[model samples]
Target: MPRARNTGSRSPARGAGPGRAGTPGRGQGTPAGRGQGTPAGRGQGAPADRGQGARGRGPIAGPSNDGQQQQARAPRRRRFRPGTRALMEIRKFQKSTKLLLRKLPFARVVREVCQDVGGVDFRWQAYAIMALQEAAEAFLVGLMEDANLIALHAKRVTIMPKDVQLARRIRGPEKGFASL
Candidate 1:
């Protein structure tokens, strides 16, 4: 039988050397030029050999390992004092409250009531306005209750002059009904 052919070799069947199977044959100096030479494989035997002294360097050294340890042990910084933070919160609340008051139409009535109650001081105005708003809310609730009572007790109803005036204003004079 014929000899089994070694298909892995690149050399012809005549005269091939031991290192000629996959090794770089001639003038290839760098490991990359060689077939099986990985950069990691080159650094495998001696780790310290591929140190900062290599051809291509990495990023500059940061604060040393010791410096990082010291920084980690350093005291934390205080962002704000408790009193200062409270004051800031109060000021923000006041600003938002003032903006809301300005946008509300009924805020004028509340302000007028505050003025009548001698709430001239800027700081005291907020409390005075709050009181006026509460009073107006109570008055509106009372008026609604009276209207409901009148609607429910229709038999013994007595309309006031103000109600008649309101009705006359709502129903303007017709074409020839003014003389009557």
Candidate 2:
């Protein structure tokens, strides 16, 4: 008979099983550490892994690639509604009128009205102040009416006549009479 072919001995290849060795296989046929070694150190170092981890943070953290693409394509936003815009124009008019009245010397107007209107030597300053207050009230009431008209027609049109008049009265010649 032929020799027993070492049937009773355990082979060294069998001892290289995964659990028995500390290092796993490297590439296809090279030894464990010969080429790129363990999976952890093969590509970039550990610091690169940490840097990737840090990037995935904050409120929008971990949005897939597609989500970021969609956000970039979104549109811009508008700041004001038609009704609010009308009111803003009226307010600008009111402010400018008040500024012009302030620059004029109302004391002279008061002195003249008192001297000319009443012979009893009444206070003209008080009358001038009252006139200014009445003018402001009239302007405010007109603005309110214009605002109402703008609101009533807001859904159907872009401009209202009452609003235009108010703008003209307040802005005078400075604003080139821009209509609402």
Candidate 3:
């Protein structure tokens, strides 16, 4: 428990009749309702009663001196560390090539064969996998183009296996590319 505040002695007027002056009671000084308070310009006035509304201290809401509506602030830009742009570009390239590889029929087969190589600790990246797939596809395409030419030269529309063998032979064995 705490001790009550000792206001010294009580004045006679403070405990006087209800209608007496300088006393709080049913008198002319009592406020009526919501619209009643101390007169204006004495202290901080109520927002509803002020001439400038509630935005007295803030920037006025209207067009500027240039006769244009206030422009909204632009969104913040992304900041990257120094030398990280190359890393970001490499990741982007990997992602794009990975997406392209998804559309190729031999992508899965090539990835699996490289991963399943025996007695080797070969690790495959997206670039390496894509490189191998592209080289193989190019070799096949060139060989087929040559075989098609050979067939055309032979007065035939269909290419036989011998045409492909001849094409490979013409490419020579020293190139390390074996026959189909």
**Which one wins on TM-score?**
3
The TM-score values for the models, in the order shown, are 0.24, 0.23, 0.37
Ranking by TM-score: 3, 1, 2
Off by over 4 Å in 1: 1-103, 112-124, 155-180
lDDT by residue (tens digit), candidate 3, 1-180: 664442544456433456653223334553322222222234444444333322234333544664433346556799899769977986786576343344355666765676687645565687777777777756776788899999999999788999988888888885527644
Best lDDT among the predictions, by candidate number? 3
Q: Which structure is stronger by TM-score: 2 or 3?
A: 3
- Whole-model alpha-carbon lDDT for candidate 3: 0.59
C-alpha lDDT of all candidate models, in order: 0.46, 0.51, 0.59
Give one digit per residue, the lDDT tens place, for model 1 in 1-180. Answer: 565543444345323344543233345432322232213235342332232222325323445657768677879877896579877976786576333233256666555666889869333456665766666555544444454455455553454544444434434565212332
Error of 3 at 42 (Å): 99
Worst ten-residue run, lDDT, model 1? Answer: 32-41
**Candidate 2, 63-149: lDDT as tens digits:** 575887868887867789658988888789767645334424555665576778876555545656767756755665666556556
TM-score of model number 2: 0.23
- If the candidates were sorted by their lDDT against the true structure, best first, what order would they fall in? 3, 2, 1
Residue pairs with colliding backbones in model 1 are none
